[model samples]
Target: MVSRLGFLGVIARLFMWAFLLGLAVVVLYPLLWMVLNGFKTNAELFGNPFALPTGIDFGNYRDAWNRGVSGYLATSVLVTVTSTVATVFISAWAAYGLTRVDIPFNKVLTAVILGGLMLTPTVALVPLVRMFQSIGLYNSFWALLILYTAFRVPFTTFLIRAYMIDLPREVDEAAQIDGAGRWTAFWRIILPMCKPIITSTVLLHVLFAWNEYLFAMVFTNGSDVQTLPVGLTSLMSKHGTDFPVVFAGMVIAAVPVVFLFLFGQRYIVKGLADGVGK
Candidate 1:
């Protein structure tokens, strides 16, 4: 009887594994299809969507690389990189100050910052556009950069501060006794210690900025300044029925985000577990 129960348990577990594996394939099949179709001619693609390409046609990649999408990708990289760095730095400093400093109404200020997370950016687009226009940053890269950094800061700060609040207070005290100022301790000790959470936050913000379409479209007008998501829309409108080129652009657009998510997943999990009580 004991041997029979054990064998049945193993079978059940295997069934569970197979179910989950099937589910994963189900979820990922569309992405796989998109990528594979990019390498096939239109007829070959539509005729047999699931079949492998007869011959690997690299034209899609070449066309995408030599055209508008490549430059758009460069713009995306620039914006996402700069905005992620700015958001992380400013958020780290703000979180460190909020956690370490003994200032009046600090709690209130932290609450205020946290409240920004509650407000959706879409709701504030008109006023924000006007504000940026007045400040001479509208329709430019700086506009997108500033908007990305500002909108991302609240959650990033909240994440960092959650982790910061849990750190050992003794480190800060010891540094102070050694004549280290708040900035010195934060820069030298606390910042270094929060590398995992910082990395997670930066990666998250980069993905967000890279994928965001509503703000990018509203704020950026020039082709030279447009990022991948916005540029892809223009490409689609101008290249109707050119599915291969569109798919090619889509693949190029997905590269950074896919790579980041796959590689930074561990840190992302760690940060969420530590910061948001996950």
Candidate 2:
């Protein structure tokens, strides 16, 4: 019986490994193909889309950069960084207030904020456009910044608040006893304690702001302020026949977010585990 049990365990282990290997291929193969295609010539790509390139070529990448990818990349980076900072910090403060403060109608406020999660961006598009236009913010960098931050705050607050709720109240009491004000304690104590969730939310916001196409497309008309997602579309249209350059542009756009996820995946897992597990 022991030997039979051991044999079944081995079978289950083998099955798990096989499943993982298949999943990896499913995820990684397309990305690998895309990167490889970026190096191939247009003719080679059409001739054998599945095959590897015959020679390395940086020209396609250079052409992509020179065309307009550099500008798009810069815009994406600026918007992503600034908006991530704004979203995370604002959400953190809001989370602290909702979870730790003694304000009236706190529950109603929490409900109202979290209700934003149910609000669809598409449903509000026309109204938002008119509002931004009326405020003279349409087609501007600040427009994207405000929109990204505003849209992201609620979900970010939810995550941080969940994590904060699980924290011991003693931490706040200890800080208060030490002559620390609420703002000081939050900035120095609770905020630092919530680092894992903060990192996760920052990465999540970065991904959202980096790849956001609808708002970027609708809000910005010029290449100078358009982000990677919108700019990639423009690149494809302008270089419709230059498929390799388009592939290179895609690779360029994907690399940063990929590296970011790879680096912060641990924090993401931990933060969500701690936050949502509550």
Candidate 3:
């Protein structure tokens, strides 16, 4: 019976490893193929889709950069950075208030905020467009910034609030006993302690703002304000035959967020676990 149990454990381990290997291939192969294709010429790509490039070349990447990708990348960076800062800080403060402060109708306010998660972005699209246009914000940088920040705040607040709720009230009492005000306590102590979750929310918001398409497309017309998602579409349309350059543009767009997630994945896991677990 002991020998049989050991054999079953070995089988289970092998099965798990095989499953993981398959999953890795499924996730990584397309990315690898994309990068490899970025180095090939159009003829070479059409000639043999799966074959390796004849030689390493940077022309495709250069051409992609010169053909308005640089502008799009800059716009994406601006929108993503500004919106992320707005969303995370606002959410953090809202979370701090909801969890630590004794305000009137606290539960009602919490419900009203978290309830935003149920409000579909598509449902409000028409109204948002009309409002922005009336305010002369349509096809502008601030339009994307305001939209992304507003849409993301509720979810970000929910994540932070969940984590904040698990923290002991004694921390606040301690700060007060030492003659610290609420702002000082939050700025010095609570915010520092909430770093793990804050990192997670920041990463999440970056991903959203970077990859957002519908608003980016609808709100921005000129190449000056268009983001990667919209710019990539325009690239494909304008250079339909130059698939290599298109692939190169995609690789450029994906690299930052991919590297970011790889570096911060541990924080994301820890934050979500601690925030949601309690």
Candidate 2 residues 169-215, lDDT tens each?
A: 99999998899999999999999999889989998999899999999
Candidate 1 collision pairs: none
Winner by lDDT: 3
Each model's C-alpha lDDT? 0.89, 0.93, 0.94
Give a tens-digit lDDT track for model 3, residues 1-278.
Answer: 99999999999999999999999999999999999999999899999999999999999999999998999999999999999999999999999999999999999999999999999889999999999999999999999999999999999999999999999999999999999998999999999999989999999999899999999988888888999999987767643569999999999999999999899899899999989777
Task: Mark the regions of model 2 whose C-alpha exceeds 4 Å error after superposition.
Answer: none
lDDT of 2: 0.93
Choose the strongest candidate by TM-score: 3
TM-score of each: 0.93, 0.96, 0.97
Over 4 Å off, model 3: none
The alpha-carbon deviation from the true structure for residue 112 of candidate 1, after best TM-score superposition, in angstroms, is 0.3
**What RMSD value applies to candidate 1?**
1.9
